[model samples]
Target: MIRRWIAVAVALSLVGCGEDPPASPGRFGEVTSAVVLVNPVINQGSTTSVATGGERSGVEFQAEDLTVATDSTGMALVEDLPTGTVTLDFDPGTYSFQVVREKELYDVVLAYRDGTVQPLFPPVRYPLGGEVVEVEPGESIAEAAASDDTIVLLKEGTYPGNLELRAEGVLIFGAWSPTRGPLSVIEGNVTVLGGGNRMRGVKVTGRLTSNANTFSAAFSDIASATITGNGVTLLRNRFTAGQATVPSSNAVLVDNTGIP
Candidate 1:
């Protein structure tokens, strides 16, 4: 009996020494961290180039109860963010900004909080042009365009899965010739992370996010569009459902037909 009591005591001690039980992740899943990069007020207008000054400071970052201020480098290391907390509110004294949580890092962009759209990702600078690659339906859009290839021409067919634009200045067109059939279809959500990208003559059946800078789409059909980039223009495009958000003063929606 004494040995059993000792054993119970030892077990209890071990339980106490062990790390506290992990907090429940809730419906959003495990908590994560993202590095938030912010540009200066002058650089905010240009996603591709940095202005005379470095990254700006004094930006307010808030998620839940956690609040942080950007350091001298205009960057904030935001931690303990729920995976479901895809968007965080940021306010620079001069302009309102939105911080989007990417898979690995956070992207900071100028946005107005009108309670219209959700946040997404940001871009890395790539060259303005690259070789064109032809992609068939059912082929991987991510794989069809290599790092060096920028233009992705989709033949008349459906591309599946969550599509991404990783290369800068990429053009994903439906490849319509004089003999036009149906528009090429992307049967998944698209997350754009490259700067100066364009999409034309395609049908996106899922939500579309232009997270990079200077994204333009023309004559395409999108279910929904979340424009997070600067200088984003949606022209002559049609939307089937959901809402279209143009929070940036630089973003333009021209002659677009949409049910939503």
Candidate 2:
């Protein structure tokens, strides 16, 4: 019985001394990060050029509360991210990308990613002679009206200075600019197509059409044309009635109220 016990003890010690099998590598957890790249195309009226590669401007990455990340080679590293679908926010632009991992590269082509990530530079839409020009927010419809070759199709938004439709054809306004700041003032025959457009400190000297919509102007003066809209305000300007028609919802005041 003693000899048997000794043998059993020796066997147990040898088992303990044997090296344990190597641990399996841990599974790669879900990791992701948001990345934004700049668009390369430059508009006709734009004064600056678009950036590319590492020199691209307006590129950014946002994950949770952090907005910065590192881009090495062709891949951007968003380390230690939880496993899930990650979104990348960028400016109103286009980009081409390649994912690089362990010396392997994968091409990534994205058309557009919409989010709160505002573009550093505003996008502009130049008229191709007679094409319909949609003025987006943060965009400007400058020199289009002055061009004798192009017919300016103005959308809903505030414009800077007095808009002049010097040509013979019709020039439409009310297209919304992205910024929607007070600098958007109209000085031409602006047709209000939709509601909820804010026009502050604007001076109109041409025909104004409501088109079953509302227009808000802090201070405006109507001269030699008809004003047809619901909400038209003449807060501080003099209205020399030529063919001015005020709609029910349109309000025409004679003093500065507040920011619209």
Candidate 3:
């Protein structure tokens, strides 16, 4: 009887000594939030320049698989960003941004954020001829005639001649006097320079592009023209015609005067 009791006690002790089940592992914590800021400027006029904010004041933020958030102060807060380097994309405009990690702060000037960095300066001005270059009525000139090297100066007179620019280059139509009228008509790829100029009387039978160089025109008439290529900017330029078409190859740069 005594031996049996001792065996039973030993069995109970062994059962108690068995290892307990392992505790479950804890989960990862949530990621912290980040913020960015953007500011843009819109210019309107010729000799006089002004900076004002309109209904078009807004910045777009792009990240991989993440939607960015912005506040009234132009601060963009990025959520759910993993613990690694992140790339942010923005529109074509000037931006002042700051990156903060813990208590450390980083200041940066971002003109563009994507695959490359573009210059922040506006388009370079190409001077028109001191004397206007007049084209006679019913005259036709080829791209070779209007050499890409020269800036054709249109005089303040009726030019019934047709101008053609076949090669890739800039055609600057500037006036010595601010009061001088704009180009009456263009038949090829050209950049009209000067503000408050009118293109209502002008007719474009070929491709036409503006580098946002700030030229004025009252009426614009385009026919089967593709406004494509780099540095093709248009700033407050009006277009009017009986029939006009914008080709898929054509692109317009707004408020961008960068060199091609």
On residues 1-260, what C-alpha lDDT tens digit does candidate 2 reach at each position?
Answer: 00111211322332464722111111011122222323323212222322322333334655444564333312233333333333444443323222222111111212223432323232111111233233433344544444333323233344444343343332232322212312223545655444433332234556655543334442234443343455443322334444444433324332222111
Over the stretch 1-260, how does candidate 1's per-residue lDDT look in tens digits?
00111211322432464622111111001124444445423312222332223335765756556887766645555556543434555543332233233222223333222322222224221121345455667888887654633555566777896988887766665743222422688998988888877776778888998778878776577888787767875644677784766544665544356522
TM-score of each: 0.47, 0.26, 0.33
Question: RMSD per prediction, one decimal?
Answer: 19.5, 28.4, 30.2
Q: Give the TM-score comparing model 1 with the true structure, all chains together.
A: 0.47
Better model by TM-score, 2 or 3?
3
Residue-level lDDT of model 3, residues 150-237, one tens digit each, is: 3232322333333433423333332222122233445445443322222322445454543332232212334433332223334323
lDDT of 1 at 230: 74
Better of 1 and 3 by TM-score: 1
Which 10 residues in a row give candidate 2 its minimum summed lDDT? 21-30
Off by over 4 Å in 2: 1-139, 142-187, 224-234, 248-260
Q: Best candidate, TM-score-wise?
A: 1
lDDT of 1 at 246: 52
In model 1, the Cα lDDT at residue 133 comes to 55
Q: Global CA lDDT of candidate 1, please?
A: 0.52
Superposition error at 42 for model 2 (Å): 48
